[model samples]
Target chain A: MTKYKINLILALVFHLKLISQNFNFDSDIKISEEFRYFFNDPSFQGQEDFFPSYSLTPKFNIKFNDNNIIFRGFFRHDKDIRRTHVDLREFYYQTSISQYDFSIGYHQVFWGVVESNNLVDIINQNDAVESPFGNDKLGQPLSKFTYSSKNTGIFSFFLMPFHRKIVFPGKKARFRFPVVLNRNFIKYEKNNKKLKKDFAFRWNHYFDIVDIGLSYFNGNGREPIFNRNTFMAFYPMISQFGLDLQLTFETFLFKFEGIKRTADLQSFYAQVVGLEYTLNNVNGNGLDIGMISEYSYDDRGALAVNSLQNDVFIGTRFNWNDFSGTSLLVGLLSDIKYNSQSFSCDFSRRFKEVYKINLEFQYFLNIDSRELLLPFFINDHFFKIELSQFF
Target chain B: MKKIIVILLLIQTLNLFSQSNEKLGFEIAQKAVLMDQGFKSLSTKLKMTLKNRNGQTSERLLENKILEQVEDGDFSLIIFNTPKDVKGTATLTYTHKIGPDDQWLFLPAVNRVKRISSSNKSGPFMGSEFSFEDLASAELEKYSYKFIAEKDEFKIVEAYPVDEKSGYSKRVVYYNSKKNYRVEKVEFYDRKGDHLKTLRYEKFNLYKEKFWRADVFIMKNHQTNKETVLEFSDWNFDVNFSRDDFTQEALKKAGN
Candidate 1:
């Protein structure tokens, strides 16, 4: 074992001894099931009319003394015209010490992004078309260590070394393992009037709202450019600098974030900026409205072979507490240059605890006429219904 | 004919207006309480993964059963899969959901079941980072609530725990107005009634047109400075279970 591991083990042993004398150990379990259906447009070719997906996820958690641990595993089975069987989704362990904490195994790590639209998140496994861009691969191991200094500030470092596999339909893909690292440091000032207490170095604040970060990676996971003979070379060295800012005045909440990524070549640099604002109470009935927007620019100050892509989105939500508590949400996304549009709506109703029901609808428009643009603009409609009971 | 049609339209409009007055928050809390009352027994499969400080990981799987009777607040039996240390372990609680949810654990290694006091409920469950409070069914009636605001799609409410010994003193809940029974966000308060954590629910789905469940639940604890994100899928409810399944003999027979 490494020195760090030895130290950790010793500390754990000491703590466990103390806990066994004063506290007791306990355990719990949770089980869940999910069913999904997908309908594709027949005109799109090689599309299926109905695709059903099911998953069973069981979770177990335990605690001793002041220390706690969690473990969860996910299994997915899909029945479409093509595939059927159980696929392992995720398995990981997480634990914490005084000011230090760690997680390892097949886990998901989310960092620096508005809805995970930025480049910092690497463990995203969402397959929904509405989800932001991210990669999900198995066999990737991630570790994160964090420290806090009470009233001063907080800092954390995250590292991951793993093999990334990219498989295309009907073809064997490529695989590469690389080392990735991310570091974040944040400081807060006292705002007694707005907050109950002055800003202090704490894990919850530091991990949830990272103010400053530096990220870098070295890997050879580039997609093959020409039939496994040629590969597109990405700058082996990439670094990003970013910050998150929040402003709260009266009942209004405003948030702004920006991130910049630099590569060896000027053309490969990327920058993203995002802003959101929510106004409380428009009319009576407690109606509030909010707007969110983000913009990304790539290939700045460098020669580029393709045109720059821009994306913009806006949405609003309305809630009514009366009438058994009902909620409604609608959002729209538009690719200005490509003239593509996506719209979604969600509605829910809670009847006295016996049952609750929710419905969602989404539509994606395919506007690209060129075959090259089809990959990014496959239009489709999606719908889902969910019901749950408390017992 | 025209006069009758106009009268019927007026009555329908009146009914809609009356229905709109019932707040979403109130409905959700009411439903939450009802759901907690319907269960007589439960059976589930559990998988646990442990990650040590050194990054080594291990996983284990087991089956669980619980038999409950609410009239006397008696937990007849709780059983676990058979294993040398764990098999045939059954617990019977004389009084649960009262002052202290009394519990007992029967360990095959000792050939006896041990009583668990109220103080022990705060301990971790298994080797995971969850506590007994997290495992227990939250009683909606245990808290009093006030409607705070109605946003574009949800009604936000604040609930104050009536039980002094409850883990949290206060909570803020956001409910979907259209569905009138879904929770979007829940903010938990510490013993001092200070905001300590926030739990957000997303990806709501309607199952069997009777229930609405969130696919993801992210809990951020402020006091301890930790976060737990639960992404749940494949939810099957109403599976048949019996009191015999929760017996110690059955647990031992199953082999933990």
Candidate 2:
């Protein structure tokens, strides 16, 4: 005890000396506002009219030396005022020492590709019902550490040994509806504790142009709802493994990933591949083309028929200097097997140093069994506008 | 005797002109960098407005302070103000001549400050268009230069980067013939040997009749499609700043 106390005191003194000797501070404040409205057909549950959602995210970042001690908060107000919510999106303190970097508090950890659904990134399970694009909150506070080296590679480890409040579908209900409630506490007992851990290793030897990585995690597949305490205590254990590889040659880049999950004597897997190429010289304008496909298989094939999922997307973006301030992107997402397609276009313009504007339009056609398991078909459209300023 | 005197005078004037022009462009290039350096301490309040698509706007106000000392190279402190949660954070940077610079950030909430790696120096600074390399003090030895244009009272020279990691492959600077110092403008070239950006200095003011400071500087990035306007006012030089002022303890106490 005495030795530990002495070490603590010395450490405190050393830090104090370092702080007193080299003090510097800088801060940047960023605020963003987004407005989105979607129109759905009668086949969907929601009304056909416009429904607006607005969010304001404010971020303040501070650092001492090379560590980041950031505090972020967000407030969202929808046309449905009754559902307004204020959230602490990010409240993390991160720092690095030698080859090690770590972060604590509520934060987002993005590790892989596939923006909407990252099979390789399993740390934070997201809300599936909130937004189809998975834009709603998906991360939670935990502890994370990374050991990285430019000459060698990187190794990372993460752990979340605790649970927090969550919302889930209610039990014994005629209609499927989500209910907000605290997670069951009885499971915290020493004998019933559930510990979640994730590990990843990445190597980039081809001049940072080619990257390969492997990741593994052991945890519950998603947030859980209580099941008569007895059944809940027997939660199924899940094991997931993934591999990622990316290559950049000259102006062309390629990325590929595969993930597999094993649980309850069953197995599922997904694979993704993407490619992007830049036009060598077309008045300095660059063009990128990308495609993504996802497949899933259940060894048992008992729960859902077909047990296979596939999605493909194609996009094109154009930038011109004469318009020095304008950019446009158009893309299409389709389930070829189901004959369903969705098209989206986004355009942005900067008026000056003080003002910028963006508009997005999306339309979905023939969304049948490919959307959800339901046989219903409908047409939907969404329009979103955003304005921002930098001072 | 008259002919000899005229010839000598002409030679002397030409020699002075050549010397003045030789260092002028280089000095201006150096001055553009030096004016922002060697501050014992500094504090500022700034407001940022972001304009995004869809016609929505957001703004934030912040206050910051910096303390600097030239030891071996550079040792400094940076502090941020606003959003009480991050009020007492600081960052320290130390540059080395042989290798890369070392950095550290201290967080009051965590009660710890950690060192930064060298690889990250090429990354963006706080999501802005500026990179870490743009923030470092540029040493004279980091580049080689040659006079490309010599006009009546000004000289233009091109500088090539010696540091392999520098964001710009080359830079062109314009200097004044009379001062043997002061850069009027700089054009930066990207790694692909293309003109990438230009920095223009204006509103020059003489400090202590020895130092020339430009009150306004505009940096435009062509590739990233962004620009930054830096306006400096209320200048103070050679202020009393001690080594203790740059320490971590000083940072916590000096919180804005």
Per-residue accuracy of model 1 over A1-391 as CA lDDT, tens digit each: 5999999999999987887785533332322223333454433344444434444434444555434444444444443311222323334454545445555555443344343144343333232221222133333445655554423334555555543333222111001011111111111122223322101111212221223434443222211111112322221233444444433332233344454544444214444456655543344223445555665455432122122245565667664423234668787766556665667777777554234566767766654443222343253365666553322
Interface RMSD of 1: 20.6
lDDT of 1 at B115: 31
On residues B1-256, what C-alpha lDDT tens digit does candidate 2 reach at each position?
9999999999999888867665764665666455545445554444433322333433333444444545455555555442233445667655554455555466653233333344343344433344556656555666766567877766778887676756667788777756645777788887788988787878898766666767766667676556655556556565455444454334433442
| Predicted candidate 2 versus true structure: per-residue lDDT over A1-391, tens digit per residue | 9999999999999998887565544444434456666555333343334445555556566666647666666565655332355656567777767556787877554445432235565565443323334345544677777665535555667776543333332231111222322236324322344355333333322233455667887765542322432434223356778876656553345666677877764467676666645442144322222232333323323232221246566666654322224567777776645676768888877554345677888776656553332233244366778775533
Q: Score the docking of each candidate (DockQ).
A: 0.02, 0.05
lDDT of each: 0.45, 0.54
DockQ of 2: 0.05
Candidate 1: list runs displaced more than 4 Å: A1-40, A43-45, A81-95, A123-140, A166-242, A249-267, A281-287, A300-308, A319-328, A347-358, A370-379, A387-391, B1-256
In model 2, how well does chain A match by TM-score? 0.73
lDDT score, residue B82, model 2? Answer: 27
Report backbone clashes per prediction: 71, 58
lDDT of 1: 0.45
As for model 1, its CA RMSD to the true structure in angstroms is 21.6
